[model samples]
Target: MRIAYLILCHGQPAQIRRLVMALPPSSPIFIHVDARTSAAVHAEIHQLAYLRAHIHFVPRHRCFWSGYGIVKATNQLIISALASGEAFDRATLLSGADYPIKSQEHINAFFENAGDAEFIEAFPLHAPNRWSNHEGLYHGASRVDWFHVRFRSRAWRSPWRRRLPLGYEPWGGGQWWTLTRPALELIADVARKHPALPRFFRNVFLPDESYFQTLLGNSRFRGAIAGDDLRLVIWDRPEPPYPAILKARDIECLAESDKLFARKFDLYRNPEIYELIDARFLRRS
Candidate 1:
């Protein structure tokens, strides 16, 4: 089965190249580099893609952490991949820092057995998480109109609130996922049909985490969801802004997990971890 990889990356060309090469060459790779990325990094990514037949670079978006830009970049990658008219069985969203824990053949075989299930981790927005205290307020609040809601600013001092459009419920989850083509098309259709949804979410805190989850959860594909993003991420604290940077000591734990990918690796700090993974799991060394 053909799989399309939608990678949202900003920097680290070497790491991205390793990820792309680790996957099956037949898999179409659609990369969206952050608009703020350095020209040198962009050139490096371009060179890598130029040498590969199926790897292509799409338009870049100015992505900011925990901002609407994340959702924008992700949307662009998914839309571009679908528009390419590729007959892909599934589309997996990944980041530059992530590496595969399973070989390409194993990943493909796992998906082939997965049938049409969607692999997304999600929960209701009001599910008693530490991210928000006034979860119900999100229902009738225009997160965009609020002041200083983007980035590291607090959400407590919002100016005003507006109700979400009818027939929409708030949902949130981790940003990465593996989805069937129909599930992705459904999300794109929802965004296309409800232009206001995007505008409203543009101001919401970490919209990337909530937008796709809310749409997929409310749609008919909810039943197809596997409820797991299939990525093994380690957090230093229960509610940390970023995941812990993986290292050599984590290789065995990563291998033991059934997860397909692990994230937040730094070549400068833990190049050996990746080499070990490649030798033990990916068999590319």
Candidate 2:
């Protein structure tokens, strides 16, 4: 089975190159570097080996850690990968800082057995309209316009905040996903036909965590496997903006999780993570 690995890098082109080199040559790689990043780093990325032909430099935009830009970027990557007309069985989205925990052979074997089962966990979301108050959970003149407006400021509960016939449910995890071709095609079709939904979601807080999850959950592929493929991550002592970086000491956890990937690691803080996973998890070239 072929896999299209997509990574979103906000910084550190060197680390991205290293990770890309570790994967098998047959596996296609696609990257979306944040458009707002430094010009030097962006240039350095395109210069990396095997990248000139596959890389996609998405428009630089301010990505909100808790907003919709993240989702928008992911969708763009998926579309680009499919448009390549390559023989790809699945698509996996990752971060610049993440590392795979399994060998290429093992990963290929795993997907060979996983068919028709979507690995994404999805759910529904409903919330009250809050437009009456100056500061509302959502601000807009009407329900249709609420998702379109830029959230400038949240008043102390706006007049528009009102309960609707909706209740938000749990969506998918924020990081790491492998979607089948059928699923990807479905999402692409939905995205084109319903432009407003995606735009509306883009205005929502943490749309990455909601947009795809909501669509898949409401689609015909809802009954598939929710989560599998071992991926290890250590959150901060109390958990900060990202998960805890994996260190040499965490190598044992990485070996034991049986996951395909683990995340939220920084190469600068713990360069050993690279060596550790390369030597212990993946085969030496």
Candidate 3:
């Protein structure tokens, strides 16, 4: 079965090239480079695309961190991949900073064995102790009325004091996921049918973490979800705003994990980590 890798990238063209080259040539790659990036970066990505057939650069979206722009970009990638008519069985969303921990063959085999299940992390929004406040427990109460707003270059948490529009129970999780083509189509359809969904999530805090999860949790696709995204990410603290950049120290743990990919790597900060991975994981296959 064919797989589509949907990568969202902003910088580090060298790392992006390495990521693309490591994947199996048969898997189509669809990338969305942030529009705010420099021309040189965009040119470098275009050059990379020239080296591989079926590697596409979708329309650029001006992505803002922790904003609806991320969801918009993801939707764009899904649409672009679908429109290509490539017969991809699954679409895996990843950031440019991410790299595979498993060999491409192993990843392919694992998915093939997984059958039709979708790989995503999700949880009920109002589940007790799942959606927590600073006190560390949600106590099974809805947290919908609170709005996260960006004003004057800073984010402010204030009460929107309004309920969700579509009778959807909000859910949240890591945005990165591997979904079936049918699931991706369903998300696109949901977004298309309800213009207000994206508009409503635009003002919510980090909607990328919630938008997809909420949609799938309240739909028939929820039963098909495998409840894990299959990525090894290390968060520095409980509820960290961002995951810690992976380093050489993480190599052994990453190698041992069954997870297919790991995130937040920076070549500038930890070049040796990728080298280690290439030797122990990618090339060894």
Compare the candidates by TM-score and give the number of the best one. 3
Better of 1 and 2 by lDDT: 1
- RMSD of each candidate relative to the true structure: 3.2, 5.6, 2.7
Error of 3 at 158 (Å): 2.7
Off by over 4 Å in 1: 128-148, 151-157, 237-241
* Model 2 spans with C-alpha error above 4 angstroms: 49-61, 125-172, 228-230, 239-241
Alpha carbon lDDT at 151, candidate 1: 44
Regions more than 4 Å wrong, model 3 = 133-144, 151-153, 237-241
CA shift of 216, model 2, Å: 0.4
How do all the candidates rank in terms of lDDT, highest first? 3, 1, 2
What is the lDDT, from 0 to 100, of the residue 250 in candidate 2? 84
Which pairs of residues have clashing backbones in candidate 1?
Answer: 140-162, 140-163, 141-162, 142-162
Could you give the candidate ranking by TM-score, starting with the highest? 3, 1, 2
- Positional deviation of residue 284's Cα in model 2 after best superposition, in angstroms: 2.1
Candidate 3 or 2, higher TM-score? 3
Candidate 2 lDDT by residue in tens digits, 171-251: 443445789988889889888987766755645544575567666766787787464424566754565655776777888
Worst 10 residues of 1 by lDDT: 139-148
What is the C-alpha local distance difference test score of each model?
Answer: 0.81, 0.68, 0.83
Error (Å) of candidate 3 at residue 271 is 1.5
